[model samples]
Target: MAISFDRAADFYDQTRALPPEVADQVTECILRLSRATPETTFFEPGIGTGRIALPLVERGYAYTGVDISEQMMDKLRQKLVGKPHQLTLINADITTLPLESGVFDVAIAAHILHLVADWRSALAEIQRVLKPQGVLIYFHHPGSGATRNDPIDQQWRTILERYSYQADFVGAVTEDVLGYFQAQNLAIETVSVAELPRIRTAAEALQTYCDRIYSNLWQIPEPIFTPAIEDLKTWVQQTYPDLNERFESSYEVTVTAASRAR
Candidate 1:
């Protein structure tokens, strides 16, 4: 079963919020690949907590967001309370949303496609709402493709190896996004695919996994996970004795752009 965003909304931003720099990159990449101008009206499906919306709206873009979780939307509302802009949020599912046809200048599905069981339906809806020549963008933090040799990530992998690992947005990735774009006859373009370096303490990253902040964490059985956690903790102490020591990591972000036929 998919994890509920309402339950996850409490500390969602705390655990998984996009850094300000990353948010800016998303906005800039979308605009650079498409014909959207500063005044273009943008829509995002599954715009949880407005993480990606922040950068664009700050630049004076008109934005509309749709999501099923009232709690998630509520959190976004809190963030926007004193902020000013033309922002509208619909508390609804994307597939059945009653939004008008061909009205939006751009539509973004950042990290959202893989979660929808009926992703094709969601694609159709995105197609419906975008005007001819309108752009559709998908943003994703792809699965760790390059391989992480870091002890901590390796430890997690060892534990995960014991069982079949599957999580939310499991089957969704960049290739799926491209396939959908092609099926809909939208011209596809790769906007960005670059590695960003990051640093974090072993303890910090380990705690995030243990808390299962991401919905995928719940997919692992407790019996298997408990042992893995213990093993990881022991290994971390043996390797990085100082909990404050930071280690390097490479995070990859991918953005895909497509246009509705004019």
Candidate 2:
């Protein structure tokens, strides 16, 4: 079973919400890449909190979102109140969709494939539900170029490994995902949607790790996580005497649009 975001529903938006301008740009990019119009139907598996679906829904597009977390879907429902949208939310697993075949014009997989234990099955289901030549838009944050060199993130990874914390991702990485598309003979196009500026203090970065905002951190056993976090904190203090000092970076959003050859 894939991990559910029920525990994070309340704070998910606060932590993961994109800036309004960036969100609009993402929606536009999806539209341009998929060549979708109001008549195109959209399907999103693991559409937790509607971060990617809401903008399209607001534009009068027909959309359906599926997820195992009712709490997360409820957050999306709350936002739909007093808003006109042709949207449907289903509580279900992505590996086996309830919808009929060849029904949707576009499908979205954003930061979600990594969570599914049987991601191949999920992708098969997505392909099954899409109309012939329908597009699949994959979205991910590759992090700014600086992320690889960021001492804070590097330390966090080191501490995590020292505690025997392993990532629980059962799906393919970016390269594997593209390989899957190639195996299926789907035409693929990649684009950089936007690069937004971000700034945060070292203390704030530490707090985010402590809060386990990232999904990969959710699986760490309490005992292991506690010690690992303490190690991270000590490293942060030793590396930077002033925890309040802020660092600037950028957040890059990339999209890979794959379509079955017509």
Candidate 3:
């Protein structure tokens, strides 16, 4: 079974929010890459809280989202109050979609593949539901090479390593994902979307870890987790003597699009 974001629903948007302009840019990027129009039907697996789906749904495109978490989908529903939109929400797993074959024009997978235990099955399911020539747009943050320079993020990773805590991602790795596309002979088109500036104090970063807002941190055993967090706190205090001093960083959003052959 894939991990579910049911517990993270309350704070998911607060921690993962993109600036309004950046959100618009992402929606526009998907629309342009998928060659979408008003009549295009969009399907998103693991569509927690509709962070990506809302913009398109609000624009009158037909959208269907599936997730294992009812709580996360509820948050999306809360946002849809009184809004005129063509939207359908299903509580289901992505690996075995309950949808009919060849029903959608575009499918979106955003930061979801690595969390699923059977990502290959999920990929096949996405292709099965798409109309011939329909597009799948995969969205993710830039790879480790891009984030290794961020001290706060680096320190947190170090603490986890010191505790010998390995992340529990059961799905396909980056190379495997690209390889799957290649094996299927699906030509991929890649794009880097507009970067969003991020500013946060070292103390704030530590607090976020303490709150366990990230899914990767959720499964850490309590015995290891407590000490790991303490180690991170000590590092932050030493690295930023002034805990309130803000550090600047930017988030890079990347999109890879591939279409099923007719």
Candidate 1 residue-wise lDDT, 138-247, digit = tens:
87645532333456776677656655453325446666667777776777777555566667897887787778776656667888778877877887888888988998
For model 1, the local distance difference test gives 0.75
State every prediction's TM-score relative to the real structure: 0.86, 0.94, 0.95
Per-candidate Cα RMSD to the true structure, in Å, reads 2.7, 2.1, 1.7
Q: Arrange candidates by TM-score, highest first: which order?
A: 3, 2, 1
What's the CA error at residue 258 for candidate 2, in Å?
Answer: 0.6
Candidate 2's displacement at residue 154, Å, is 1.5
Instruction: State each model's CA lDDT, in order.
Output: 0.75, 0.86, 0.86
Candidate 3: misplaced stretches above 4 Å?
A: 141-148
As for candidate 2, its clashing pairs are none
Residue clash pairs of candidate 3: none
